[model samples]
Target: MQSVAEFDNVGLRYGTDAETLSDISFKLFPGSFYFLTGPSGAGKTSLLKLLYLAHRPSRGAIHMFGQDIVTMPRARLPGFRRRIGVVFQDFRLVPHLSAFDNIALPLRIAGIAERDLLGPVGEMLSWIGLTERADARPATLSGGEQQRVAIARAVIGRPELLVADEPTGNVDPDMAVRLLQLFAALNRLGTTVVVATHDIHLLQEIEGAQMVRLDKGRLSDPTGSLKYPPRPLVLRS
Candidate 1:
């Protein structure tokens, strides 16, 4: 149970604004499932941003995939990012690409032959029950359908780490369950998963999952203490 990522006294803020996150710390274990839950403005999305390398922490140390990314060269960031898959809350699909092509984009970028991608992309569409919508653009699909396509695209490359932001927000309860199952299936194959959400009911859907709750830019374990860490060090914002 080696960790995929670790944070030590990590904090993030925008400009000189109030600290959005302070002294946050945690470990994301390999092949484990985690639910990052909190109220609005509790920094759930900010945490996801740090996990996926979208933003650097304003202070403290962070490591991912055994590399210290906070200090890693900018030129090498893309290589590290490719090992991780992110399912954004907005379902950031290419507006003009068909569902099949959107799912195929990762493989295409990885230099897989177009012919070699046909089987994998087709199988992903079928798994998401979107084979019929293979030719449909994101703008033409239902919310649930779009979510499925997004999830399909994220996991299609078989990444070692998967970070999803409120992934079930656009779908019904049944579809949420199905999507969670999809993640669970991927976890079985050794993908570490981190899902950020405000939905308490969704937390109950998965037994034995880890809970990392945030309160006003602070970290807490839902099963334990709620005390915010003291901000002893000087912060940027």
Candidate 2:
């Protein structure tokens, strides 16, 4: 089976500054769950930016969904990004849109009929336990509520790849675990999940999840798993 994404000696720099990420290489396979861990200023966010196509690396290659995204035409990026979902640390929800609309944005962008959206959107609202807050705008929700809405928005489309940055940072331990379970559930359904987090406890939440650690912009594979091709994963309950 084809890998969902592959990074070959990837390096990223901003302007004339030193590379924010260097010699980073990894492969994320379909149905696999990965935990990206590091201390503060460890280039976690920069690497995630590269993963989500928010920025191109200064050097090295990145292939996703079987295509070289670095050289892909800019005009084509929006279409490609639709296949990937991202949950930002900032919970970038639209201020003007209510929770339900924010979660439904992707489907609407894909041209799903208005009638077809209510079921999925409603189910996602229910899943996040925000059904009562569906009409609330981002400003009206608490940080945790906003975070859940952001998560629900990201996964509602069920993209092939899901990338999250410090996804559980703002929630209590129980909510954090619940969010991880949501990601695990998505992974079980075959979405490749990569979560960049500083929380080490989350690493053990999903059995068989691979780990990739970063420090000062360099990659380290403590488990030595990144060197080989990934096998089909069977996540344990």
Query: Which lDDT tens digits does candidate 2 get at residues 21-120?
Result: 9998888878878888888899999998888899988999999988999999999988878889999999899999999999999899989999999999
lDDT of 1 by residue, 1-237 (tens): 456888999999899998899999877777777888889989988989999999999999999988899999999998888889999999999999999999999899989999999999999999889999899999999988999999999999999999999999998988888888888778768788889988888777776566789899999887542223211111111
lDDT of each candidate versus the true structure: 0.86, 0.89
Kindly give the number of clashing pairs for every candidate: 0, 0
Error of 1 at 2 (Å): 3.4
Candidate that would win on lDDT: 2
Residue 95, model 2: Cα distance from true site in angstroms: 0.7
Q: In lDDT terms, how accurate is model 2?
A: 0.89
Which pairs of residues have clashing backbones in candidate 2?
none
lDDT of 1 at 79: 87
> Which TM-score value belongs to model 1?
0.92
RMSD in angstroms, all models? 7.3, 1.6
